[model samples]
Target: MAPEAEPRQPPVDPRLWRYAAASRSFFLVIALLSLAQTAAIVGFAFFTTRAIVDAIAGDDLTGTLAALTGVVVARALLSLVRERVAARASARVESQLRGAVLDGIARLGPGWTATRSTSHLALVAGRGLDALEPYVGRYLPQLVQTVIATPLLIAAMWQADAISGLTVLLTLPLIPIFMILIGLATRSVQRRQWETLSRLATRFSETVQGLSTLTVFGRQRRAADAIERVTDDYRRETMTVLRVSFLSGFALEFLASISVAIVAVAVGFRLIDGSLTLSVGLFVLLLAPEAFLPIRQVGVQFHASSEGVAATRDVFAVLDAAAAASAPPAQAAAPAQGADHRLRLEGVRVRDLPPVDLEARSGEIVLVEGPSGAGKSSLLQALLGFASATGRIEFDGADAASRPPSTWLAWAGQRPGLASGTIAANISLGDDDMPAETIQQALALVGLADVDPYRMLGVQGAGLSGGQAQRVAVARALARHLRGHAPVLALDEPSAALDAAAEQHLWQSLRTVADAGALILLVSHRESARTIADRVVRLNSAEVTA
Candidate 1:
């Protein structure tokens, strides 16, 4: 049967309404503050012009000065309030977005994330989200105020004089129309540039990670040259985006300026003909630019928002990938306890590979003996639910494939995966509550007691020998053993890096673990590993028998 589809996520483009809805109260407050500020500024200009005209007309100076002073004070206070509210709202949105993205990644799990590049993911979480800052703080508030205040301001202007208001209204739409056309033209280019940037980041991360290998092969110069070429491509793409952005800005500015100029000319003619008063003409002149201000600002902000939009697309692409189908819910019944919880692999076949049959009884050792490429490693991975395998894997009469295998199995691979932290932290792997004494005991059991528990291991277990690294991996497995239930242990080439005595002790440790009723399954190329196994299963191209 074909695999079932994974759950679908929302569309790639982030919905602005969703962001507004998430922090509605903050947005509402910001909207009110922005309108208040716009009104105060617009009101200040109107009052100032009125006051100057009154002074020229030999009217009361004291009243005019007091009115202008109040306008200035109110404008300042409203501007400050707008700034404060916007900062808080932007911070809240950024926090929520970061957490949501991380949670989404977590739900997708290692199986999905393993295929993606760390650098690309980093860019999405870091730079991509950073782009949203202005959208939340500045553009969004401006958009809200423009929607609310622009109409009111225009209506007031109409009350002052119908012709001037009409002039402003007709010119307003032209700015946005020009901006939209320019945006549509550049949208595809912006998307391509973001892809190129992500590719560059991924390649740079890979090159840095493999710097040691390149140096060893005497190909560092070639790697540097390759990086330079990619960077040059990235630079060219960035310049294209910059050029388009500048052109868009210039276009919007020119349109707004022309629109304001038209309103100015028409108002000037009215004033000259005595059809409009000085106060009304000044008000219309000030409000004319204000009408086109939001549209022009939006044009500029959209360019900034494009980076985030592109990044969000990449983020959604990862979240939208179909994950491997999980086992059927009906097959997830709990396995029987004690001796019945053993693993049985019956005719387990992997694709383009051989079939192998094996079983491990409780408190027993099942040695998987084979040379390199004998499918021993692949078999272990299949058992751990990392690879798809055909046939049945029964756990105490329950199908192993039906439930999570990690609940009962502990796997130790050849390469010991360690982060840059203390030895105890590495073994516990973020289990902060794990006792230090328990960590020491596990290390001692794996013959790695010499290494300090609090000592820092460099990135990727650097400075450790092959055998020491293997021992650390073994120690990690033992630390897991310290937890309540003794899970089934499966090690691939556990003795490959140990000395004769250490290898003997490691086998003894496995035997000890097995004696405690835990199924111990190990893969080994050494003949000596057979001495510790209760039953040895040999696998070849198409044969598996005891």
Candidate 2:
């Protein structure tokens, strides 16, 4: 079957402007700076021509030279200001865009990001958004410069030489006309480039992550060849984009050059015929290129920012969906008077998991044990709201859906996430405000006291033993429980990666948490795990046993 087509995307999303903060002050600064720049450009031309004419007329040029020097200095300073402001605005825009993309991903949850490949998302957030630098820093400022300075420069030219001004006015429209025509083709190429890059990144990421399995199967060469094919395709798309950019730039340059030559020739003839002064002819000649400079730059910058424009569509699509699906504000629930904690699952079935009807209480551990392939993982996911199911989960007799997933439970997954950071930071997941003692206390409760509070662990616990990583996961859960925030604790195969001794130690830690008035829902088949349970629930097909 043929693959489905991707939906069409706009050239750029206007909503991105919302994140940029490049609105009122940004535009005002551009306008003011461009006005100053226009004046400097015109004055530089006037003074430069005046100095040259003074020298040719055999007149003393000390004053003309001084005037020219001052104008040059002013023009340079004004140019500097324009460029600096543009760079700052671009930086602010890129920073804001990146933050928005990451925040949206977090809020959207893995359910959303899992559908998009990790490498594609990473590229979008990192290198993809960097393309906006040229868009904002160079293209946008040039656009504004054209709007503000172009007319003023043309008017200055008309005051000096009417025929040359007429020539500029007639040809000015041609640059944009061709730009629009080629820009249509350029956008199409950019879209293909973005798609190819995404495919290439996805292939590379998948190949790298599965290299071990591929090697075991002796198919690593096949995977390598596939990645190389995608990379070569990406290379070709990139070259196509560059070719368009170069061609458009060359065309704009050639057109502007022709226009300037016409004006220069007319001025030179008139200068010899005594119909125009040399100073005025020189001034008109200088202003001619400035009139076309903005449009010329617009052509060049479009390609530089094209990737970012394409990436924005993806970013906004994710953010828009996340916004639409934005979880409603959780209503605060008052706990039942006399209940320590209560978790009730009424006819809950997730994926292929058998339907479950269960009730759990705090201050005790409830172990769900069965042979593998009983959908224990799916059942846990349903309870955590990570998977879809048909029944109601209640906490303290309130609908579980009424509360955000983060509100009621502290979780320790089958494989927990660990960052490369200090032990305390890892426990808090980089929330620096979480106290050091809080982390140490949690680690102590999970039988990880010997693990230094200040010690740094690599991502996925590269610095720590498998047992230690498992303990860190437990410590993370315990920290939340100790904070008196979450009432129920859900741990899925927490010791699956540990040895017998480590597994027993892990169960002892969980038993302590359960004894301390937090409800524990553990999935395990180990005899040691069952010994710590206040109640062991077994699943056989669709039946539940105690």
Candidate 3:
């Protein structure tokens, strides 16, 4: 099958203005600066032409020379101001867009992210958005200058001498036409370069994550070769983009130089025939290049900022998807108040899974039991609002979607989700000012009383063994419940890595919490879990039975 074509994108994306307020302000500032710069260009050219003609006529030239010098200085100052504004705008707009992308991802939830590549998202958020600096700084200002200055300068030239103005009007369209052709080629190679970079990131992340497995299977060399191949491809793609950029720059310069030369030739002949005065001829000759400057620079800068353009396209896709997903906005389920938290799921279905109906209130131990292929984990995900499903889920008589799960639910998944932090910090991840006593109690409940709470850990709890990490995760969930921060605790195979004694101890600890009025939702395949459960909810082939 042929590869799908990329979508056509506009030069200035409207979404940037909608999502980032800074872009709108930047445009306003740039327009004002562009107007001042245009005035300076006209004044400088007129004064310089006047100075030359006056000198030939042997007129005193102090005033014209002074005015010309001032215009030159003003022009330089304006350029500096434009640069500062563009730099600030680039930083602000990049920050705004990055924040919006992150918020969009949050609104889309974990299920949306699970289907996408994490490395690709990281690229978009990190390096991809950073590429926007040149686009916002140099390209956008030049584009705005072209819009504001080009026509005004052309009119000035026309007022001075119509033949030169007419010649410029005819030739300016050619630059854009050439630019369009070159841009098509440039975008193709830049896109390949971007995709190859994403692939390299994904490959490296995968390799690092599974390095041991690859080594055991004797596939490490092959994985390294694959990464090398992608790197080479990326390097080639980059070279191709650079080649196109240089060629386009040369083409634009050549066109602009030729157009100005034509205007100069016409002005020279008119000056000789005495149809145009010396002042008029010189003024038009000078303004001719000024008229073409902005447009040519715009063409050049467009190639420079092409990477940012591609990145913005990806950013906008995420923002658009999130907007579509949350049309009219989502009112999460209200938190259950003052004890008596009740979770009710009515015909709740996750993906293609069969509907699940369950009602559990505070102080109950509800165990989720099922075979391997059953939607046991999916059901927990539904309650956590990570997965999309068609169903009515309520907590304390309010729509469950109206509130976040963190307000009422504490969960420990199969993976510990530990970061590089002290044990106390990991256990009380979301809670603030957790007492040392409380952390100690939580550790003891999970059979880790001997472990020091203040001891630091490496990435992903690297200092701990498998069973220790699992118990630490459980303690984290239990710590939240113990602090009364959440009324319900959800653990998926909390004791999977624990030995029999540790497993039994963890179950007894859970029973004690439930007896003290905390609702527990446990998913386990082991038979020992049945001893402490108040109810067993079995799932098989997506269907749930109590």
Candidate 4:
């Protein structure tokens, strides 16, 4: 079956610019502050050289010390301000980027997310975004300040001494020339390293998630061997990246050092020939390295930032992939306000899949039974609005797509996610205002009243039996019922992990719920489930038999 065409994505680069624009004031302040700091460093270097020359020429020692002290203090304060402002800007940008990534993931839903590895997502959110910190806080402002200040510094040198200025100006291009050449060489290497890292992360995550299964099959050692191979590859790629990075740094350093030496030699010859004064020679010599400093610094920062740029490209790829847009329907109907919350999937067809029309009127139990690999799960997901489907799904005879799915239905998966928190927290799932008595009653309905909902459960439902996890999931659905809306409850394989007695009790509770006019749809293979269902629809090989 051909896949559906994805919705057009917004341009990622433009979105990045928007993110920067959101913190425009903060960036402006940082840029101005960096310039001030650069100016102070230049000024200090100039005056200190003058002070030395004056002292050597037998000028007053007291005045020179006082002036030098002031420069030192001012430079320190400027450095502090630059650090504070850069830190603040980096933090703000990181926060914004994280939020944007998460929002993009939410829009992509399970269809897109299922194709991605958890570790890859983790790296993007964790280390991938961390690489951007230096780019935003340090390199970005430095790049801006260099563009503004370098020309002015050149003009200042020219005014002081044309020979020195021209010499410095000529050497300026060499630094960037070398930087650009090395950067081009390392570009592919950086990209390869990022790819290798993502692959390694994906492998490690898979191994961890399946560790128990590997142990059960006595293949744990084999899994360890596989991880070792992945790690070795990662290590080799990392070393290659390091080697290229150091080589690039060495090239930039060599160019800048040669440029500085040439300027120093020219100034020395002129001074000996009596064409240049000592103070001006000293000033120009100091400013010569200054001219190439920003360019060289750019080289160094680029290597630090290359990983982030590569990661950002991947992040943008995820963001740019097709997503379902939340466009409002043209003829939207108001949400239903009474107990007659009938849910219906009429003539609904998912792309490249067989058509199935199903309905769950209020107070009815609909059983969706299917052979393994049938589209039962897909059907359930469609009713929950996870996947886009053709034709109309309605709530009380109104188009279901007209309103959000969460407004009137509760969905329970075969493996519902649990976090590291109290049972009540997992049940409430951040709906903190749910009354304690109501939570207890919901647990009681699922036969989990003996277990305290307030007891702390470790990560991923640790310390809970399979039955307990199923009951907790069931409890979550029941809690949704308390929202004062007769929510259409859809369960996928609710009896997969439950024992016979527990499964019977659960089915009885579901029957009771259905009897009370709450639509219940259960996906199952058990014969007992069919007994309680009002209508049983069997699906085989993607075809539904009513």
Candidate 5:
């Protein structure tokens, strides 16, 4: 296969300001700090040169040494302050970007995330953004220093000695030229390493998630070998990035050292011939290296932060997608929110499925029944805004697509979808207050009352049996409606894992909830569901019926 194409990105993405407001303030603070730091560099160089020359000439040295000491202390203090500021800014930017990425994912909906790798997404939000510390704390500050200090230091040197300044001005461009040439190679290798790491994480996650199935088919060893191969690829790419970084660092150091040496030779020759004063020559010599220091460090920091730069591109892509998705349609007016219990669908067609229409009001149980491949699940998904459909769906006369499902609908899918937490926490998911009475009522409604509310569960509700986990999921959905968070409940195959008695009990409890004034849309293949359902919506490949 041909190599993956490297994505071109700017040194500093403009989107950081838009998505992470902290970055805007960070830039302003960094600009102010860079100005102070530039002044400190000039002061320190001037004072140190003054102190050295005064001692050589047998002049009074006390005042010059004191001034030099003060300048040294100020420079160190400035550096400490800059380090602290960079650290704080790095943390704030990381947090802000991570939040925006998660919110963007929510805005894009499950349909979008379902198409992307969960492992890669986790990496981006977790370790990927965490890498921004070096980028923000070190690389960015050095960049600001280079922009501010390099020119001014050169100007100071020119005022002291013209020849040294001119030499530096001419040769300063060489470091960046070499940096640009080497940076291109560094970015390519670093991006490849980043992509390889993502692939390795994804492969390992998939292997662990399906290890049981792999072992059943005697393919576990093959899976392990595949993971190892991807790991090796990551290791090789990382070594390549390291090699390029080392070569670039050496090239920059060599160029800067050569340029400074030429300035030193000229200064020494001019002084020996009595054409230059010791004070002036010494001052220019000191400032010459300071002029080149910021730019050289910029190159080194760029290599150190290349991984973070690559990750930020991934973050920006997600933020851009969310921005695009959130842009409201020009002709469509905003939906006004109000109290209305009626659920309505008009010509709602999902994928290749035929258009569907239905209406139900409060205190009604609508059972959606169909054979396999009949689009029953897709219908629920379209209503819940998890799937795209071409038609109008309104709840209480407000467009369903315009609002999040949690605002008006509570839902449970075939999977339990539980995280590691207590049973009460699972039932009251999203409820900050965790009302105990409501938790007890919901558990009783779903016949999980005997299950302790405070009992802890493992990942994916591991402690509960399949049927118990399914019932707990049902209770959680019911609890949302009971707690007045949503007015409707959408359940898909909640009884698929239950025995006949439990299934029948679940249908009766659902009927009780419906009688108490909450609308319910249930998808089930069980015939017993129809007995309690006030209305039945039967679906087939060709059409839908009520």
Candidate 6:
């Protein structure tokens, strides 16, 4: 499935100029190479035509052939240079744009992105952005040629023979007129295709995530029906795009064919009357094809790049929203702090959940317990600033909103997203400076003494038992706890998958954390987990809901 299209804009959106400018040095080289290629095309035509006339007249051919060969070699070298520069520029621009989109997602926080399905975002970032390669590598260079080479050829043709030049000049505008009409006809369909693909991807991802639940509920057949409907829609839309593409190609080719034929016919008559020499006539004849080359290529490249153009629109929208969210309202500032290390929440409300009031100091395990759908997790989410609530959360001596998540929270989820790798790497994901000794200590704390630090684990801890997987998750939290000062350990069902023995060991690990003066927030329903908490706060399932 594909991602949804952003609002319609130009094929090359204005927001993309920043990325283009970042690769300006490479683009500059490409431009220079294009200029040289244009010159070689002109020189190539002149020499080849001169060689033909010399052959017809029984004159010397060495100089004309030699010049033609030199021009061919020069054109080949310039083409190679152009390709290399475009490739580099393509890579650089793609990297910058992908980085921007990912960074915006990071800044906006998980809560916002969670509104879209996992598969949709992944597709947009991966394959959708990849479609831009042709846009940069092939289309952009042809656009530059159309801007530079086309005019030069027309001027040269006119200088050598006025009638031939007049015919070409009169017909040139028709090519773009056809291109514009094609674009107009296909724009809405292309946008709809992009959007439908995104919806299909999003729905598939959602179904996969809930497949077990669907199977249990005996609704898998219905899910299958929904998917089939989406696929059929996508197929229909794809056919429409192909139909338009064929029509566009046929129209451009027909126009170019007629225009070139007119030039050839006019030049032939001039040569017959002795008003134009054969060399000059052949020269103008050759130049006719070159004049239409760039415009035709531009139309093809434009069609190839439609998918990327749609994705860029969505990427830019995300970037714009992230920039807006970076600064909160003036009234949202937190009140000054009073305690050394304390977390206080007052009248905090998220969605339909009842207002919550809570307070805790450092050096304690504060357990948050409740029935399903009681908004226990929502409380933690609110503290993480992922949910909008009408309340104040003060950490240390300042407002929690004033600081980023890294400064105050160490979170481990119910389903730990442990990447496929060695145990040590999972423990210290992306934080290379974290010492091996620290990771080992974290593992030992969670009672995994025998697990080798470098042992291979399948994707998301596939090879590990349920208990060991949970322990790895706890170790991740502990590793984070060890690194940050004045941090809170926030765990959601950390012992849900563990056996009695493993659960006890995990509880003991939490006790050790609480005893060491770290503030901890544990969300669990098990008696073993509740037993280890310094203070247990259990709300009735009916008390609140989000």
Q: What's the lDDT for all of these models?
A: 0.75, 0.80, 0.90, 0.77, 0.88, 0.80
Q: What TM-score do all the candidates reach, one by one?
A: 0.67, 0.71, 0.74, 0.68, 0.75, 0.70
Which regions of candidate 4 fall more than 4 Å away from where they truly are? Answer: 1-26, 80-111, 126-141, 162-170, 204-235, 261-278, 315-378, 382-409, 412-542
Candidate 2 clashing pairs, residues 3+ apart or interchain: none
Please state the error at residue 202 of candidate 6 in Å: 4.9
Greater TM-score among 2 and 3 belongs to: 3
Please, what are the lDDT tens digits per residue for candidate 1 over residues 283-355? 8887777777776777787777677656656554544432222333564443333444568878888665678
The most accurate candidate by TM-score is 5
Which is better, 1 or 6, measured by TM-score? 6
Ranking by TM-score: 5, 3, 2, 6, 4, 1
| Residue 435 alpha-carbon offset, candidate 6, angstroms | 3.6
Cα deviation of 152, candidate 1, in Å:
5.0
Give one digit per residue, the lDDT tens place, for model 2 in 362-424: 888988888777767777877766777888888776777655566667788878678887777
Q: What is the descending lDDT order?
A: 3, 5, 6, 2, 4, 1
lDDT of 6 by residue, 1-546 (tens): 897754446645656776446556655676787788889999999998998988989999998898899999999988887887788788888888788778877877876776766676777777777877887788778888788988888999999988888898899999999998898767767777888898899889888889999999999999989999999998998889888988898999999999999888888887899998888899999899999988998888877876776677666777677666565445434322222368888887778877777888878788888888777888888777677778888876467776566556777878788889898889888578989888889999999978898998998888898878888988887887786622687888988888888888888878987787678899999977767888887766446321
User: What is the Cα-based TM-score of model 4?
Assistant: 0.68
- Model 1 residue pairs with clashes: none
Estimate the Cα RMSD of every predicted model relative to the unseen true structure. 6.9, 6.0, 5.7, 7.0, 5.4, 6.5
| Candidate 3 residue lDDT tens string, 361-477 | 888999999888688888889888787788898877777665566777889999999999899999989777888899999999999999999999999999999999999999999
Model 1, runs deviating above 4 Å: 1-33, 66-70, 73-174, 198-239, 257-281, 316-366, 378-409, 415-423, 435-472, 481-488, 495-520, 526-537, 541-546
| Tens-digit lDDT string for candidate 4 (382-462) | 766677677788877777755556556777789967778888988887476888887898888888889888899888988
Give the number of the best model, judged by lDDT: 3
Residue 328 CA error for candidate 2 (Å)?
A: 5.4
Reference-based lDDT, residue 365, model 6: 89
